[model samples]
Target: MSNGYGKKSNSPILASVLHGPRDLRLEIRSVSDPAPHELQIAIKRTGLCGSDVAYYKNFRNGDLQAVAPLSLGHESAGVVVAMGESVQGFHIGQRVALEVGVPCDDCRTCQRGRYNLCAKMRFRSSAKSVPHYQGCLQERINHPAKWCHKIPSHVSLDSAALLEPLSVAIHAVRRSFIEQGDTVVVYGAGTVGLLVAAMAKLSGATTVLISDVDSGRVEYALHNGFATKGYINTKTSPLTELSDKLMAAKETAVDVVDIACADQPDAEGADVTFDCTGKEICIQAGLYTTRPGGQLVMVGMGTPIQTLPVSAAHLREIDIIGIFRYANTYATGIKILSSGVLPCLDNMVTHRFQGLDAVPKAFEVAGRTVDHEGSLVLKVVIET
Candidate 1:
């Protein structure tokens, strides 16, 4: 069947699909035209995130189950190729970054300016809804024009793909309400963790400490100047021991601790804590670490329901705030990328796959390899 794009036959179109756990298939599909409010994008760069990894490794992410064939990738950027009839404010050939999740604007949550929580949200490559929304790991993608934020002239497509994760960090930082001189600690050194640290620093945190199980990631953070102090590899050490080590080195307790680690430990002393890892254990740690009257922001997407430290939270009067995806941060993310405040974009992109045929290999490498210094970016483009 014709995809409506009317492209010449024999052109290669690549896509990634999850047949089951650890089963990613690359195939060619017909490209379609944009709807009235949508824009057709020639996808250039797509970043592999933890969610994509989860879908590739297990065909599931947290409570969301992938019951059918699904495409992978959400952190993506490309150039606009076609605009639907009613689409305005965008033109063909414009570079853009897509906001992966599009919410139904009529919901009460949306009306409340919390559109990220809208019940009818359609997020790309998620099993939360049946007939999953296809992702951008394809040659051409038709997306809502309103959700495509134009990239600044100076921002490269590689860095533009980062806007997706950067928006998450931006939301977490905003939720934490970080103030100048506040000491901040991030629990993970992964992409999101590093971005969180950088965003926290930009938000006025005087000292930012990042911890991770991978020493290589810590080294990357230190080498890239993204972190001030790094913690020893946490994979082998106990949580209490790590905390003690942090205390011994700094000689003082941190005011805020953002748990970016996938796992959590009991945090004893912190003013504000963020559970960016989204695991039950990390959520518990956020509760344990937060001081009285402090806040705990949950930013990670783990199991929908897990045992939480409710009694401790109540006793400590710590407010546990949950963050859905992100809202109203695309423009700010673009600005941040354009301003050149954050660095090491090339360093973050650790591996690159040539085409859609390499997607399965990309997922395999990302799943099995423990490389903390590099990230795997799968490039999906029209074969030149």
Candidate 2:
């Protein structure tokens, strides 16, 4: 029997699959038609997030192991090529960014509006459950219509691909409840770190400071204006020393500290601390850095089990909050990208690649590069 589209071919489309650690192979597979209430998209652009890299490098993330062959990308944007029956509000050639996770709506967590924690969530490229959901690295994808968010005409597909991570930052900002005139510190100049700083600024932060071990990223942040005070280079220095240096340089104690790096530091005196890095040290550092009664939001994904600074959190009355993917931030993220209110996008996209052939190269560049200025791409587009 012919496939859903009646398109017959000797060789199917190509996709990158993870067989094991550092084992990414391009394989061909038959394409399937979109199910009812789904849309088939011709993926145009994809971004190499840290999680994708981790899966590529280690073939495992936290408790997610690549027990079976799996596609390796989730941050993607595409154009609708076909729509299934009952799929409305989208058309052919419509550009879109997909929300990769689909939850069983009947679950208690899902019913509680915590869909990210739903026990039956099938996230693309995730191995937490069997019969893993494939990702959007291929030429065509069939995705649930509800999970797809249309992109504005002014916003490029590259920027749309960023919507996923941007939503993460937005959710983190919401969790922090950053008020107007708050002083914010982001501890990592990576994409998420940079995005957090930018979002915090948009959320009415009077001052936003970002720090990274890479001086290049610091310089990039300064040039891009993502941080009000530029990037803080925290190389080989203790947390206290770094905090002192930042305060001396910026002339104020950071009110909100967002830890975006994988390695955390003990940054004391911040009213709010966010651990976006998902590393044990960074988690501990977030707790240590938060002021009494402040909040620490954990956004990054770490090991299923890890040590934490319970004593510091309990003693200081720091509220530690966990963040799953995102709730309803796609439209907000698009607005932020389209309004041009956030000037960080210009500087954020430091690098660009053309065509699907360059995807592997893009991953290589993103993986090996340490300098944010030279390597940080606020958005990377893989064009046809």
Candidate 3:
């Protein structure tokens, strides 16, 4: 499809806007012209994320609270329709995955190749910043051309939209410092968790295991070959008594994960563990499951303050790494997705919505505790 819509029209574009908690509105807003270094893209697909659900249900996620109306959505892919004078290396009709965060290139972090931590970052759909950096839930959006990565012709726009979360997984895997043939365990079977599992296998992990409170997700991971083995947290436990709870959690994981990995009754530790669920119990379970001197990568954004097994980590000398949003991962993520190695990658989209008008219902569906078939909602995509 030709991406160029030609010159801007005087009419406004229909957009999905969030006024506050559970207050979503369909409105028309003036289209923005691309800046000297930007491209105006017609957003074709957007994946509704957990953060979006948090914003929709609570009007806040973590420390970020919405004080003003903001457009909602970040995981998006689109076609470049217009470009500014300074834009280069791209032309009209290019399919691109929009990197939602635009970092200030001059920042020290950016200079050091860690632009994801740029203090002046303007992240889409984030209300933490003043003047509210809006998102791509609109018909047209002007984004920095540098942050837009072109996708392979074989990649569907829907799949391209998922590169954002895949980038997060790539970053998590990178931070774990996984060695070839290392055993890896990923906690949580959500989109990021599943991607982490898939990436771990692709990174040459000897055995990859996944655990989730949702049985369906664990089953999905195992059946889809995302993980070599999967564990379902059949029961919920309160987050207390670190030592006792850690032991119990580890034993529980051993009972399930061991059957899948070692085919033995006894439990063994993984060389690396990834906690994609921010739940306190999941974090403890991941830490407890990692072997001494191994590594733990925390990728989930959960409660700001969490209780951790500090003594265990210190005694075991397990390296603990925390990652915020991804940096320098879009290219690698897109390349991996385009490689067509992940046969089940496209199946991750368990639900889909039609247009901007479906945005609210999309979010509502995304916020559901149970999915359409009463299973976990792995991923939801909105085609605009």
Give me the candidate number with maximum TM-score.
Answer: 3
Over 17-59, each residue of candidate 2 has an lDDT whose tens digit, in order, gives 7788766677887766677888888888777778888777788
Positional deviation of residue 9's Cα in model 1 after best superposition, in angstroms: 12
Per-residue lDDT of model 3, residues 62-125, tens digit only: 8999888989899999999888878889989999999999888997899999999998999999
Candidate 2's displacement at residue 206, Å, is: 1.0
For candidate 2, the TM-score is 0.85
Per-residue C-alpha lDDT of model 1 across residues 1-384, encoded as one tens digit per residue? 333445443345678777899787777877656677888888888888888889887888978889899988888889987777788898778999899898999978999988988889989988887879988888887898999999888887778888888898898888887778665666666778788888988888766667655677777877887777676433333445544543432322232233322123553455555565665555655566566777777777778877664777798788877777789999998888888888656467777777777787677666633535454222222111
Ranking by TM-score: 3, 2, 1
Name the runs in model 2 displaced over 4 angstroms.
Answer: 1-11, 230-268, 344-347, 371-381
Model 3 ranges with Cα > 4 A deviation: 1-6, 9-11, 237-248, 260-268
RMSD values for the candidates in order, in angstroms, are 5.8, 5.6, 2.8
Scored against the true structure, residue 43 in model 3 reaches a CA lDDT of 95
The alpha-carbon deviation from the true structure for residue 181 of candidate 2, after best TM-score superposition, in angstroms, is 1.4
Model 1 segments more than 4 A misplaced = 1-12, 233-268, 368-384
Backbone clashes in model 2, listed as residue pairs: 264-282, 267-289, 348-378, 349-378
